[model samples]
Target: MSVDVFTFGLNHTSAPLSVRERVAVPGELLRPALDALRSTWGAAVREAAILSTCNRTEIYCAAEPQVVDQLPAWMAQFHKLESTSLQPHVYRYQQNDAVRHAFRVASGLDSMVLGEPQILGQMKDAVRAANEAGALGTLLHQLFQRTFSVAKEVRSQTAIGANSVSMAAAAVRLAERVFGDLDQANVLFIGAGEMIELCATHFAAAHPRGMMVANRTVERADLLASRFSATTMKLSQLPERLADFDVVVSCTASSLPILGLGMVERASRLRRHRPMVMVDLAVPRDIETEVGRLDDVYLYTVDDLGRMVQTGTDARRAAVVQAEAIIETRVQNFMHWMQKREIVPAIMEMHEASEKVQQAELERARRMLARGVAPEQVLEQLAYGLTQKFMHGPLSALNRSEAGEREQLLELMPQLLPRTERRR
Candidate 1:
């Protein structure tokens, strides 16, 4: 099978949430989507895996090289989106470039929040799901295995992750920008998911005046709230309690907007135009876009937080130089292994040819012994015959050749012989 690594997707860089959400593959639908991709494209996609988080959705495949060209079309058809809609936003990488991209992504270099460790786990989960679906093969398997090792190395050797501001941390930063310090801010979190939990953790570290977790399930909200010594409520209660908080951070999986413009306007009126900082980390966006226009409301999306988090990226430029050196060396080693593997079929063919020569000469010697030749003489003749047969073609060619031809053959003879014989 012709094997290649290819990656294609859009992320926080190439597209906004409006574009991203249209192509975001829900975890429940991932397997079916993969199946559809494989079936739609057939043999071109021999093995495939997808990593679809809120920040990015990427397809990694080990297949025929031509599939790289077909991916955009496949994605458009599968998502029921226009080709133009995806073409402007997608990035594609092939072969070593794809491998490097996968490694960087797993290592968090490609993250919206650089060097964040959560993406590595999310990638692992994607690989595991692909494995369960029988879509992972030697190429993708080795790619991900090395990707994890590279990530581990980057974390252990570099300070890339140090002093990094996570999305949750950035949400807190944006809140601080509005409220000066979070100490007096009453922080309200929407959703009891991992994102909300992480935001709650970071906001709690700021020692907010009050913290509350709101979710569809009050029990789950209460469960997460207890960890931070915060209170809990149902999502239904948010409209009434909205004005009570000075900061709201939301990341939920709801298909529709959870916090609408009217709701925030009402909350602003309730608070008498007191400024409220709102951060929407959700894909579809829990908060309405028009809410950002409200005079008393400061609304930020994940992209806004992403821009804010990029502030100290220049500081990490030194560490990036060092990390790139390590990754380059590893890439060369992996490419070398791949190069060696490519020659295996030719090596096996040469070995089979040599075995045939050996077997044919042995049979000839056995026939001489069977003809009643003396055992010692038979052995001597066998050795002589084997030597002559091996060298006959080259020696004959050398004898009939001109001066330079004979010189080259004589030079090669020693190398053609066994080591001990050549030394003697």
Candidate 2:
């Protein structure tokens, strides 16, 4: 059976955030998820890796024939969802298409936000986790290695990432929409993670009247705060001070909602229902959904940020043509390698058959020489025997063909035969 490369998943285009979050595997769950994927299929799947981001949940694998089709079912089983429900959202790519999809994803061509650089980092992290889980084999290893190189090539060769609008930048734009002038707004960043640090930089550039970072760990919050000449607040102080900030941008690793409706309601009451903007960059969401429903609160989730970052897609669209030309060439190169690999077993079988014929002819020639037969005669016999043995299979196949096949084989026979037979 052919063990082909495949990529299967649902992304922002294929599914909404509700479906995405249901299947999305967090960083901590990646290793176990990979292990489960391999153990679930055993020998049928030779290699596997899972890339689960806020916008996508993809499974890349090299597997035997018929195994590629099992992924949707496998995913449904893994996520404890109905197979039918997942099928509409799932997409599958095989062989060249698989490689192309991976290259596109790493290059940020397939991202919800066109040309965002964060996906490359996320893909690298997924690869590392897959490597640690022992899921990377020769096919997957070469795939990602080439994927990284292709991403680099696309980034360097084209203006794909120019004028990139990141999620943090989007959060700042949303804040400005709510308050009109960010300079007059007091911005508070909840959680000093990478997204928050980025948001802090964007907001600080506006030179907000006040900037503070609140985190469960004050050390991390303080570290990020120092860069912007901002102050750090404890998570415990959120309820008391959440009312003071006009803009709140949050991203955290917390599993549960950190900012609930009750706390925000109290905060709104204290502020006399003054308009406040809240941006949640978390997957599970750092703030509650109910918070967005409040009269004076404006809440934006990661999905909201995705739409915000799509402003200059027209410019990025031109770069895509150039990027695709590079990716198509690389895809052909990768597919050629896979094609060579597919014929390996046939090549090995031919080698073994030819070796056996050679061994038999060599033994007979040796015996003929030992029996005082002339060297010239024995050499002639060995040559004829080896030639006949080599031609036997092709000759038989050609002779057995009925009509159309026979004509094709007759035409191909000269090409397949040695120069000596071709002359005959």
Tell me, by TM-score, which candidate is best.
2
lDDT of each: 0.86, 0.89
Off by over 4 Å in 1: 217-220, 349-424
Displacement of the residue 379 alpha carbon in candidate 2, Å: 1.9
Put down candidate 2 lDDT per residue, 1-424, tens digits, no spaces.
5688999999989998778777878888888888888898788889988998878999999987688777888888887999778888889998899999999999999998888888898899899999998999989999999999999999999989989989988888888887878788898988877678888888888988999999999899889999999998899999899999999988887767899999999999999999999998887678989998999999988888898788777978999999999999999999998888778988999899889999999999999999999999999999999988888888789788899999999898778776743563
- TM for every model, in the order presented, reads 0.84, 0.90
The C-alpha RMSD of each candidate to the native structure, in angstroms, is: 4.2, 2.9
Q: Which residue pairs does candidate 1 place in steric collision?
A: none
Worst 10 residues of 2 by lDDT: 415-424
Clashes of each: 0, 0
lDDT of 1: 0.86
The digit string of per-residue lDDT tens for model 1 on 181-265 reads 7888898999988788889989988999999888898889889999999998888888899999999999887777999999999
